[model samples]
Target: MNEPEAVDDLIADLPEWATTEEIADTMRVKPQTVLKWNKEYGLKTVAVGTRVRRYRKKDFREFLLRSAEATD
Candidate 1:
């Protein structure tokens, strides 16, 4: 399959709500990079309780798609 399709499949397999580590693992990046994306690239996050944050799979998918389109 093409790279985009493979990436979509990978994102589809992620849990509905994911942590920074999970996203970093799926994208083959360090967890720090995911946090940086949240701060720098408008990667959305949902606050869980008071001290935690989770990322929605759909948002991550959209972010990836947007990044891809921006580069092309």
Candidate 2:
């Protein structure tokens, strides 16, 4: 598959609500980097409880697409 399709397929496999570790694993970054993205970039997350945060798969997909387009 082409790059975009491959990216889509990868994103499609993510859970509806992904954890910091899951996002980091998918992007091949550290979990701390994912948290940094949330702080610096526009990666949004939802707080589940006092100490749990979950990222929306759709938001992550959009972020990846935007980043790819920016590099091109």
Query: Which candidate leads the pack in TM-score?
Result: 1
Candidate 2 lDDT by residue in tens digits, 1-72: 127677788878689999999998888899999999888887899988877999999888778777766657
TM-score for candidate 2: 0.80
TM-score of each: 0.81, 0.80
Q: List the residue pairs that clash in candidate 2.
A: none
